[model samples]
Target: MTGVSRLDDPMPDSPSQTTPIPPVDGVLTMFYYNDLQAAADWYHRVLGFEKILIAEGLVLFRIHEGSQLALVGKGYGSQQPLAGTNKGAILSIQTRALQQWHERIASHEAEGIGHELHRGGNGRTVEFKVRDPEGYTIEFFEWVE
Candidate 1:
């Protein structure tokens, strides 16, 4: 992680003299849930995401080598869970084993909300969407080559 700069820091005389910004090493996407444990179980059982860290009202899962997914419980995050519909965001995962993933998720019909694999626009990729316990969409896709 990079150090935070203060607002009162001296300004650079020119662009070349400005402090360099550090490179981003990884990314983390946080999702809020009312029932945190239930959501965590669903993600583990269906998607096989391994939990890296667990804390009070927070759970982090390793999505890949460089990215992670954080699940924040109610009252711990800025926004509460949507009452019925998940409208704003979709958690998308890109993979090369499209059919395999579809089959794996399809087997867990009780927990997996939807499993309709189809071609994306312009025939560039094939994808499918599944809803988590809290109605958040998780899309898996594979780029066509």
Candidate 2:
């Protein structure tokens, strides 16, 4: 208790207790896959994400400082992957090294990685999209000044 705050302390009604709570410390987006290990390996090899943790049916990769990507095996979670294209969503990551990432992903011969890197219509970002082994779209972009 030396360096920690306790709710049971004398200041039970302190502002900290009444506040809406602190800002979100991090974010993790989950993608369901029938082949979890294959998806995990694809993310690691294609994107070069670092594996921060792994479990029975889930593997977490750190995208950056506070963002993570979670790959969940089918039947392990509430959601299961669809038999066809899972176009429900896309994961877009903002980075300053877009070209570097483009080069790395291109070398892997990943599907959809052949798309040319182009600037946004708004002229604010340069980006390209690549499909993971499971057909998940992962977009990498860099904001322009």
Q: Highest lDDT among the candidates is held by which one?
A: 2
Model 1 scores worst on lDDT over the 10 consecutive residues at 1-10
Model 1 accuracy (lDDT, Cα): 0.83
Model 1 CA lDDT for position 108:
89
TM-score of each: 0.79, 0.80
Candidate 1 ranges beyond 4 A from true positions: 1-21, 110-116
- Identify the runs in model 2 with alpha carbons over 4 angstroms from their true place: 1-21
Residue-by-residue lDDT tens digits, candidate 2, 1-145: 2554443464757687677767988998999999999999998987889999999999999998899999999888888886655669889998888888889998888898755789873666789988888888998888765
TM-score, predicted candidate 2 vs. hidden true structure: 0.80
Q: List the residue pairs that clash in candidate 2.
A: none
Expressed as tens digits, the lDDT of each residue in 7-111 for candidate 1 is 356555846356666798998988899999999998899999999999999999999998999999999977777765454887889998888888898898845
- The lDDT per prediction is 0.83, 0.85
